[model samples]
Target: MLTVDNLVKSYGGAGRGRRGGGPSEPEPDTRAVAPDGSRVFAVGGVSFTVEDGELFTLLGPSGCGKTTTLRSVAGLERPDGGTIALSERVLFDSARGINIPANRRELGMVFQSYAIWPHMTVAKNVSFPLDILPSSRRPPRDEIDRRVRRMLEVTELGAYTDRSATKLSGGQQQRLALARALVIQPEVMLLDEPLSNLDAKLRESMRFELKRLQTELGLTAIYVTHDQSEALVMSSRIAVMNEGRVEQIGTPDEIYGRPATRFVAEFIGTSNFVRGTVASVRGDTVAVDTPDGRLVCSGAGAAPAVGAEVLLSIRPEAVSLARDPHPGAVNQWAGEVLNRAFMGDAVDHVVRVGAQEIRIRSHPTESVEPGTRVHLSADPARVTLVPA
Candidate 1:
C-alpha cells in the first residue's frame, strides 16, 4: 500500500569520493547537483511499490542508496525530486512542495542499532510512542496499555515486560524495538538492517521470526538490508539496487533465477561467470560459445545478434556433477576437481575445465575427492545470459 515514484535524494559534496567498498560488482554511478551545486547523489531516480501485507525489501551493498531511499520515504531525508504516497495519501511531493514531517507520516521504523531506551522497561518502551502523541491523536491510557501488551505478546516479550530494556539479549532487544514500532499501529514499517547486530545464528533464526510476525499481522513493510540471504528468506519481493539505481525487482526466485543484469547476477548469490559469444538466437533461446564449451540457454530476455559478447551465469547448485558424462546432456564439460569443501548440507567442488574454473555443488553424499575427474552439466534453462 505504498508507492514511490521517481524518488531522488542526495548528500553533501563532502561525502563525494570513492564509493563504499564491499563484495560487489562495479557499476556506473550518476551524480546529482545539490542546491549549492555539490556532487550529491545518494539515490537517483527510483520508483517501486509495496503491495498490501507484503514485506518488500530494498537490498544492496552499503552506499547503494537502499537506506537513503528508505529514509526518504520515512520523511527523514527530503528528496531532490519526485513523489511518495501511502495508500493514495500523499506523504511527499517535491513538485508540489508538500513534504510531511517524519512523525506525521505515521510510519514505524526500527533502525540497525535497535535504539532501545536504556532506562525504560520492555512495556514502557513499547508504550512510549503512544503516550507522546497529541491529546487529539493519542489513545487513552487503557487503550495504550492494551496495544503495548498485545505488541509485547506478538513479539513474545510478555514475560520480560518488567525487565529493563538494556538487560535483554540482542535478539530480545531487537524484538523490543519491533514491539515499540508496532505499538504505534503504523501504516507501514521501515526496517533498516534490523537484525545486523545479532549473531549469525540469531540473525538466521530471527529472519523466520520477523517473517512470521509480518505474515501474521498482515503488515505492509519496506525492509532495507545488504544481506542477500536475509532478503531471500524474509522478503516477499526484493529490489536489487546498484549505484543508487534499481537493477531489478521481483520475487526472490525470479530475481535470483533470472537476474536482469550482471550486477544482480553477482550480487544475489555465488555464480560462476562464463564469458561467451552469441552463436545463434532462436526466440528466447540463445547459444553462447564460451571458452570452456558451448552453452545454450533458454529464457533469455534479450535476443542478441550473432557474435555479441555475453556472460553466462551459472549457480554452483545448477551444475550437476557425475563420475561419468551423460553423453547427451547440454552444456557438458569434462574437468578435474581443483578443490572441494564439505559444507554440511552439500559439497562444493571447483572443477577446472580447459581454461575456466567452474564451481559445482553436489549432494553431501555424492562428494567427489579433489583431483578426481568428473563431468559437469547444467540445464539450458538454468543458464542465464548477461549481455556485455
Candidate 2:
C-alpha cells in the first residue's frame, strides 16, 4: 500500500574534519553524521513497496535509518530526494515538488513514547484525531462515543476509558495509544518502535496482540524497530537496512535462513564466522581448510574459487557437540571445552578448536565440561560461505 523510492537524507558538511576523525564529514549531498562517528542518512537511498494490508518492517541497528525512513514517510521530515506513494496517491515526490502534509495523508502513527495527553481521558485521546475530519466525514457524537468505546474494548482498555492517561501503566498507555491510532480507521499505520518502552515480558505479549489487531483490522503497517526478533515475529516481510541503505528484503524465514549478505547473517542471529581457504568444489558442496580441519559446506549463493579465502557463517545451534566422534561427517572439529554457560533450556559451550573459538549449543542434559575433549560436527547445508 506504500512505496518509497531513492530516498536519501544526510547531515553535516562534506570534506570538513571533526574534533576527532569520525565518519568522513557528510558529503555535499550526503546526510550529516551523528556525534558518535556515525553518519545519518537515516533513510538513505531506501526503496521498497508494502502490499495492501501487509505488515512490513524496517529493521536494523541504531542509526540504521529505519526510524528516519518511517518519519520521512509520515511527512515528519523532508527527504533529500525520493518519492513516496500510498495506494497510488502521491504523498511525496521530490522531483515533482509534491509533498502532502502529514495530517492530510490519511495515516495513523504510534510513537515510541505514548503521546497521550496526561490531562485527557482514554475516550478523549481517541477522539482527538476525529476532530480534524471534514464535517461530512465526521461521525456524530453518539457514533464517535460508540466507536471509541468499541476500540477501547478491542484493545482491552474498556474499564479505563474514563480514567486519565497519566495514571495508566506503560503497557496500558501503549494500548491507549494504539486505540487512538486505530480509531481513525487509517488505511496504513506507521509505528515507530511503539513497544520499545515495555518490559521484555510485556513486549512479547504485545507483539502478538499487535499482529492480531492488524490482521483483524486489515491495516497496512510500516513498523520500524531495531529489534530483529520483533521484526521476525510481526512482519510479513522485513526490509533490512544499514547505514541508510536497504541491504535486503524478504520474508523472515528467508532473511534468517538464507541471508543475502554477511551483515544480515551476523546481525539476525548468533552466528559464528569461520575463516578458511577454499579447498575444493565438488557438485553442490565446497570444501574449505580451517585451522581445525577440512570442512565441507553447501554453497549459499556464490562459491568461492578454489584456494580463495572465505568466511563460513554458521549458527551456534547448527554445531553439534558429541563426546564420541562420528565415523563419517563432512565437517568435524576436535576441541577442548573452554567454558560453558547454562541458559535456561539450552547449554552454551565455548570450544577452543586450534586457533579458533567455536560456540556450540546443546540441550541442558548434555554433559561436556571445561577441559574435556569434544568433537563438533555441523550439517553441510547449514554452513554458509561468504567472501572474507
Candidates in order, TM-scores: namely 0.93, 0.90
* Over 4 Å off, model 1: 14-37
**lDDT of model 1 at residue 286?**
95
| Residue 272 lDDT (model 1) | 88
Point to the candidate with the largest lDDT.
Answer: 1
Q: Write the per-residue lDDT of candidate 2 for residues 1-388, one digit (tens) a residue.
A: 7888777666554432222111222222232345564543455567789999899999999977788889899999888777899877999987888999998888889999978998898889988888668899898988888889889999999998889999899889998999999898888899999999999999999999999989988889999999989999999999887776777899998888767678899899888888889898877789999877888888556576898998888888999999879789878888899999999999999999888799988999985889999889999988888668
Model 2: residues with Cα > 4 Å off, grouped in runs: 14-40, 282-284
Instruction: Predict model 2's lDDT versus the native.
Output: 0.84
Per-candidate RMSD vs. true structure?
Answer: 3.6, 4.4
Deviation of model 2 at 289, angstroms: 2.8
List, residue by residue over 89-131, the lDDT tens digit for candidate 1. Answer: 9999887889999999999999999888999999999999998
